[model samples]
Target: MFESIKNLFKKEEVFPCIIFDGKIMKYLDLTQKQIDKLQEENKDWTITKKEEC
Candidate 1:
């Protein structure tokens, strides 16, 4: 039952996000401009990297 429900939303890939100061504020679906802005704001830490298997 649970397996069937999980399979319904299965995806080939997942985009990771960043959690800081008790907030989730990063995503891979951002546009290039948004990414640049984020990079400028959070220069101290690197962005999450995607994994391929």
Candidate 2:
């Protein structure tokens, strides 16, 4: 019960990613503008969001 209570105050990490050949490549805590730039840079790749870390 104490462990669960402690976890409630802890923050979860999130990441954006581009999947290439069914593999996850995570970019943690990147700004929206940065993600846009990366999208422009990698036009051939598909940008997607990971659930959470």
Q: Score each candidate by Cα lDDT.
A: 0.54, 0.62
Candidate 2 C-alpha lDDT tens digits along 13-43? 5466544433555555555566678778877
lDDT of 1 by residue, 1-53 (tens): 99999999875443454424234544465444555676788776555534321
Best lDDT goes to which candidate? 2
Estimated TM-score per prediction? Answer: 0.36, 0.40
Off by over 4 Å in 2: 1-24, 51-53
Worst 10 residues of 2 by lDDT: 18-27
Cα RMSDs of all predictions?
10.2, 9.3
